[model samples]
Target chain A: MTKQLRPLMIGVVGDSAAGKTTLTRGIAQILGGDATVVCLDDYHRYDRKERKELGITALSPECNYIDIMEQHVNLLRLGQPILKPVYNHSTGTLDRPEYVAPGKLVIVEGLLSLHTPALQRCFDVTIYLDPDERLRRRWKVARDTHKRGYKPEEVLAAIERRMPDSERYIWPQKKAADLIVRFWPPYGYFDENVDNRHLNVRIFQRHTLPRPDLTAVLDHSHNGRRDAISLEKDVWSGGQPVDILDIDGTISREKAAELEQVIWEQLHFSDQLHPELLGAFSEGARERHSDPLALTQLLIVYYLLTVRKHRPVEIT
Target chain B: MTKQLRPLMIGVVGDSAAGKTTLTRGIAQILGGDATVVCLDDYHRYDRKERKELGITALSPECNYIDIMEQHVNLLRLGQPILKPVYNHSTGTLDRPEYVAPGKLVIVEGLLSLHTPALQRCFDVTIYLDPDERLRRRWKVARDTHKRGYKPEEVLAAIERRMPDSERYIWPQKKAADLIVRFWPPYGYFDENVDNRHLNVRIFQRHTLPRPDLTAVLDHSHNGRRDAISLEKDVWSGGQPVDILDIDGTISREKAAELEQVIWEQLHFSDQLHPELLGAFSEGARERHSDPLALTQLLIVYYLLTVRKHRPVEIT
Candidate 1:
């Protein structure tokens, strides 16, 4: 009998606190309740004490079971299930392996998702979160110090220790990305009072994959003018040619909806999908925010859905 | 009295045989009879014999009256008329000066159009033609050998002699362009049997100016496909970030017309302009070919008109 068609796989790779989980969460929400999510960090072979004794950070490939990760990726691509390992961040220890069944859509996110050529080939689409170093450091310190019970000094020290490994292994993976997303402050506008809501984002849509065209929605007069969103073509950075979509953190609710409307109109198959699920970030049990984040999530969802539609029909 | 508002100035700069004249001619046709066209080659102080005797090529700044060119550009910017010198290519000699008055639009085309900051600052828009070296050399040899009474070997020798000057003076002006246009053969299909009609063009829309949004009309899947046209984002060349719009030379007439119609609809004010006047190349008397050339010309016209719309109205 012919093999059954497997699930669509998307890989999200980035440095720690580079917003991989946030991006994956937004994508999962858009794909509805059925999409399965996995983290490659779960493949870690050493606990915190073991890593400390070995003098290697979790960012190093040597600290993880790369072979097992590759095997699991291959299995998932073939519609087979795997017992996935778990690394508990809070307790800094390894938990029991949990059973994971491939679903219609599978999102694999972690630092080393694109590390191996075999693993990279398993992804239908790949994204790399490349936020500014300063912002990423801030996010890491805040998360570790508050939620993970690590002191501020300890978090800073960990980041410093991981820098070498990140540069050697994690950063090079950016070259393999179909999209490189960076979040930072808008040019000439910087304030200490700014929060995540006030941060601007630059999404670099690479030629590795077909990108959603934003030319119709791009406002040419918006360059250097104050606009919540803008599209720039042919921006050169470090000798790489990239098209940039700039979304201001201060984008208004009305403008955000209008932008979403434009994107939604292009997604003819997404009518059944709830529009409200996009661009959402929750704080505790009560508060949620949406603006530029919603727009960013909407673009990603658009790309994923487009890839699905273009996939060749399989025979069983 | 306050100086009268000048006509819109557009500078088209490129190296020798880079299709600057063809592009300028198309724009002139689209703009109708009122646009004043000036060739900066008129500013050449030395004739062909003089340049040869001086052991210098016309590409050198020292070979041209740059001070006079700057003064004329300044005068044109203020809506004043100038007695512009004429360099007669047919006879390889300087001709009588002609009176030139600024009209609704002024197009200045030549090698040094953007060579000086003062001249560069006078234009509302600038375009740089950067065709492939092999294609440009072919165009140069064909044009000179056929029309200018030069032998094939003579044309090639002239090109070789001018290489250093072209590199030192002409190519550097590409960095100042708001748009860099390159027409070449599509990857992998190379044959001497192909003509100009089979050349593909990549237009790089830089972030330096506000670019018209073409997202709604962009066909992303056309990148590697056999589509007649496509737009790609985040294409890196020599490590620079750029958005590319590729127009296949083999694009069918129907497809070209359809693409032109889409662009024309966006140009709401061009109702009086005849669309047929675009993308024409002269051979003898009446033979004309239309394909991707027409579509490329339409986009440039669209951009020029858009810039005119945003220009602030002057009170009489």
Candidate 2:
């Protein structure tokens, strides 16, 4: 925050249950207390019951105070404070607003972070979670039931209801993203598979923003099989050429740590950050780690830090 | 708004019972639907009960979220909306927050509008209300007892407790004001006099910002006695020389209307605004209008519109 620098802003946008929170939580853990993670649910224009009565899905820009969202992000970029609105998830009501002052890093994660050009201008780098549709549905059901107290059938119904708005207002933002993160289950795996933790992670680094050089680690890493962490040229779903870093879910933590080491060297702040704190997920009451997820977070961090090297505080 | 102009910002600041709300309301009414009057109590960090238990008065910057106030003002100046905190004065509790989008004129009235350099930068023009201490004390007792459910002695005690902070944090802001407005009863009148409405109004034009050319009307007008509306140059208590516009409350509505006509001619928007709507005040359930108040509001509008003439759409 010193040295006359505006906080680095990173946007994480995705459809519901696309692992946005998990990714954001890991990034926050790595960035530690200096990162202020803003969840966009706080901008909801209608509480749950109101939305149901109005028959408006939350994914619609009309269902949130999008203008206020733009204003809050712009204020955060100026290193100013904001009295942010809060939308309660468990109770499906609007909670008391909270005052948040921007820290060294501002990570805005939500369903429609890139819904408008004004919002897009606030970020130094943007990541869009485009997880496999089936896997996302499963995650949504699991999350709603476990955390939000929604029945599985109700969660499914909500997903179905949200599909149109999600497609219209949320998915198109992937084209505007600097990086696209997609997690997918392995072949022949069903939704209830216990090995769902082994879902493979793929990160598409578009040329819109700078990214870490993972090709070096992939070609020569002293860990598991070279294929465990690999980079391949690919055409993005958005019709752009991109470099996709593939992290196998079967990859060992040692392999993931080795990959992270490369990014840590680029970051130059590894000692202050604990790599072990990354990729933390919960299995019922117990906690588990996903190496693929850990590597994905490391790549995102590396990309975030790269922005500093490319442009140091040209923020208005 | 369609012309891509940033809203005009006029800051009205004063200590408790200096008539900030009355002045602000008159200005808002004159500006019609295009004015947004933001009361400063929304930024109170502690509710009334909390301030009592903590033995902290609201005049201290520490007792309020001054930084958030600065942030919200800056946002409003940018014509962006804010989820503003609401401190319920009647109940002395923090109520539900409200979303406020700026209209053409954003009139911020508060106890500490000019308290900080950042807050000072948000205004196009700033006003400080500086009624005589005894008169102000009477106003405070009356308002608290009538509107906030406080007994007369209890209100007086609270005022006594707040005096130190008021002197420390509130009064000094007068130095930053563009216009210093003071309302005082005529000679020999006590607090309970029915002729309190005949108080003289003095507005000190500090030349910190552009003001309407009021001297033209004072020197020659079509109504009242020669000295009913007069201008005098005086040395400010802060040591600066200022031109004070004095308005005799005893001046008839015809005299006030003549003065308002001069400002209206300068404003060029008289066709859309009704002078009759100005100076509205509530005495119990009855509405009353003070000619002195009406003339004051007209002068404020004249100063506000003059800003557009001096610097148009240069807001950053």
Candidate 3:
């Protein structure tokens, strides 16, 4: 007569090219193969031609079955399997629905994962990537032109055209997030020629959940003054306060290792988390690297594990 | 036909009990005796009793002569005099309008100084006080119950009643500010027994104005981690990035003095800005204090002096 326990749900919501996929991939790698990633982008009701003909961008909620997504999220939260719709990104067409079973961890990531309150409430942790607009546009251009076989001008035009819908749909969901991850060029280092490796990341820890206490690991002596990394208490617009943890792109390998050790020790997992798997991202045999990306993934993993440790015995 | 030099205008706007007067008084004290402060609260068309009778709060635009205030601000920016309305807080009645001439520095502090684009454009610098709601309510309750002769219940009722109007009118003006000053209880120090001197202050330097370069004086080594004072680059909710300068309440006198000296040296004023005068505020001969408040005042003074030094030769 006992109810079955559900998988731990994490939601990652952001605009196109806001690094949602990379973030999800990193966290999944850290959690090992037991994690399942569900791309809500697969729920797109229209193909590229249909969207173009209708003059509607993929960012618009009207273009997606939001209610179905919400229902699926609720079902997944109850440890149930669902036939999820699939949309092919490279082919720009709808694919057949696939049966997706709940795993130990379910990471739902896409433009509208947090658009509805019901969907938002389903996740134990929700993250929104909010990289600088200029940086995001550059990422989009690089991604669409190189991988998606789109001309540079077409990608730029699509981005510009999607701005209104992005503002209305994707951006507002940022407020609902438990954590907001923003990647930008470091202060005084913003230049047209800056590399992605040189971009700093800021993680805004909203007061919605119990955040990991980094006091033991944080070098208080080098507090807000250090260029490598810092954590600060801040207030958001509308007066909602948050804690901002900033990681510089120039963080030394030694510093990164030290930080990783602190977080790993705190997690107290019986199976030690592999350090190398934390920030690993690859593209066609080429490895892309970022220390900030690793730390962010580790932080999300910490939250997931904390939820698992604290789950009610009855549910288990 | 010689053109006259205009007064340097600074606007301070916030909701009631958001500490507008204290901020203005400190800045005026630092600027010496010649500075003139104009209370835009004086421009209220309806007296306290009248507002209550009409079921209108003081926060609403309709209850105040915003047009007259805006016109007067324009005149003051041009060093012109105006017969400004006076709302006597002690009597809850409107007195005869008084003729006021602009000094070298004209500080306009009240609820709606930055409400209109016309009014906002008149100031060399515009500041908005955005104290925490809980802390601000505590301040309001204390002030209304003591100075304004309102019952505790009455004050609480008034705050609740004014919420809709405050939202409609007062909060919207925050977006127009060049700097936002937020005073709050530090994280984990929100006990009822905590003293006001122990509160933290955060200054959001918006992208509206070219902020003073404090890199030479700021201890960047301490970054966002110092127990006393720290400065950080941060992003606002709507994705407009800002530099957040945080001042801890427990900042040592020595640390405060050292910071003050660094700022003063950078100003290079022929008439040395007095350290004691910088952050001075009084309550019935009992001198109340805060190091963060002093530093904030000094920063404003630096901005004012910078504008003065850079004014066109024709205007001078």
Candidate 4:
């Protein structure tokens, strides 16, 4: 039986609270059994306590082992297993290392995955999450305080201190990314107190990787759902020409479903992969679905599952 | 600057408490900054508590991430860095991972280092520690109770439970080793109260790699010490044709020094590397020197440093 020669790798890079985990989870869930999610944060050179003592931010290149990260990612890209460390986010300590094997698609999610060219070459598809600063701070405070055992003030302070490293190491990686995904509050559409579930998503598709064409479907599918979906060719950050796809937070369910079908069909395995797992987010105990998140997730998975013709992922 | 294409690797494998660490430490200490020591135990899939819950022995391949180990070893062989996991033996937990860069010589030490051909190929030289079972048991009991936080009875029980795995997974790996090092109490010469530092060492030189010629020195160096050093061609375990070099624990200080000088000359650049680190071992908290161990360690370092001529390891 013939296989894909090597496992497909996708790198999802972003700052903390940039919804990278949420986006990667949706893609993995949508891809079903074909994806393995690896967090690059596990390769931190220093623990949280050690970082504080050393007076270094985790976002700095010096604070992480980029060389080891490159080797491990290359190994996974070649369909080899790696002893991946487990960083206990809640306890802020590195726990036991886990044996991680590559699936047909390896989804590497982290802050500095695209920081190095060596790391960038390992990924078949790359994404950079660029959530607006205000929304990211809000998300960080909520997630860190509730799930990561941090006080809201500590979370805010960390974000404040991480700015220099974020610009030096993180923001520049967007140039290496195939897609730059941004979620932001639509100024007049919602007040400053807008909840996360209603944020609009704009996907900047670069020429680095071939992305799905949604303009034809967009022209016919909206069906009176105002500003629900649109495809526009524009110059993004750093004057890079990119094809942008926007999914409005106020999009109606029926219109969102139609756009989802177009992107899902573009991925070419609608009958094989289920759609129920897409776009599900949690707020404490409450689970909610966002149309914008679902479309963004489906678009990202489109890049993953559609890169090559089907050879039966089961064989790989 | 021209240098060796790859870093030289040495694998020292054995069952628990087989003197792998002691041998590797001496080699690294003798080689000074040119060596990096990696313990295979850090690739364990289950921690001490989890191993107990699962009722699986660490000696078994199932308890360790051998695939990950193979990949990481390959990376180091290419003069690469690895995010190596640090297993805390005292706490019986896997703690923070360490970022380990390959030095000129990487001394990989632990059980199952030579368990597979993939791992075996990574080593330029391989040594297996096969201390006599009784001596090994004594060493394990002493070590586990004092350093590893276990009772003597518990250590004995663990050794008993690990026997099947040791036979199945550990013993067979000796065939892949270039040198089989055995430390034991000489039956007729020593009583049951013989200490660890006084144990005799038998070096089983396999024909896998070109070994140093110690026969010329051994022919005349014995002078007055009975069985102080001897080279004998014999069939070792499983009818393997082996050249055995035996170092008696009771060698005279002058004779041991002469043999050490012979082996030291064979290694080249005796002026470059200091000879003080070879024979040091701790009996409880007291530092002691052993003639047999010093010779055995010098012999291993001879294989490592003499494998290739002076290409200036500093370039690597």
Best by DockQ: 4
True contacts kept of 1: 0.00
What docking grade applies to model 2?
medium
Residue-by-residue lDDT tens digits, candidate 3, A62-120? 78877668867776777766556677787787644555777867999999999999999
DockQ of each: 0.00, 0.57, 0.00, 0.64
Q: Which of the two, 1 or 3, has more lDDT? A: 3
**Model 4: residue A182 alpha-carbon error in angstroms:** 2.4
Weakest lDDT window of 10 consecutive positions for candidate 3 chain A? A219-228
Task: Report lDDT per candidate.
Answer: 0.76, 0.81, 0.78, 0.81
Off-target runs (Cα >4 Å) in candidate 3 are A1-4, A220-227, A270-275, A282-285, A310-316, B1-316
The candidate with the higher DockQ, 2 or 4, is 4
True contacts kept of each: 0.00, 0.57, 0.00, 0.71
In angstroms, how far off is B249's CA in candidate 1?
Answer: 2.1
Error of 1 at B199 (Å): 1.4
Of candidates 3 and 1, the better by TM-score = 3
Instruction: For candidate 3, list the clashing residue pairs, or say none.
Output: A223-B225, A224-B222, A224-B223, A224-B224, A224-B225, A225-B221, A225-B222, A225-B223, A225-B224
Collision pairs in model 4: none
Better of 1 and 2 by lDDT: 2
Indicate the residue-level lDDT of B69 in model 1: 79
Model 1 chain A scores worst on lDDT over the 10 consecutive residues at A216-225
lDDT tens digits, residue span B84-198, model 3? 6677889877754454778877999998889999999899889999999988888888778767788878988988988887888889999999889999987888877656766
TM-score top scorer: 2
lDDT score, residue A196, model 4? 70
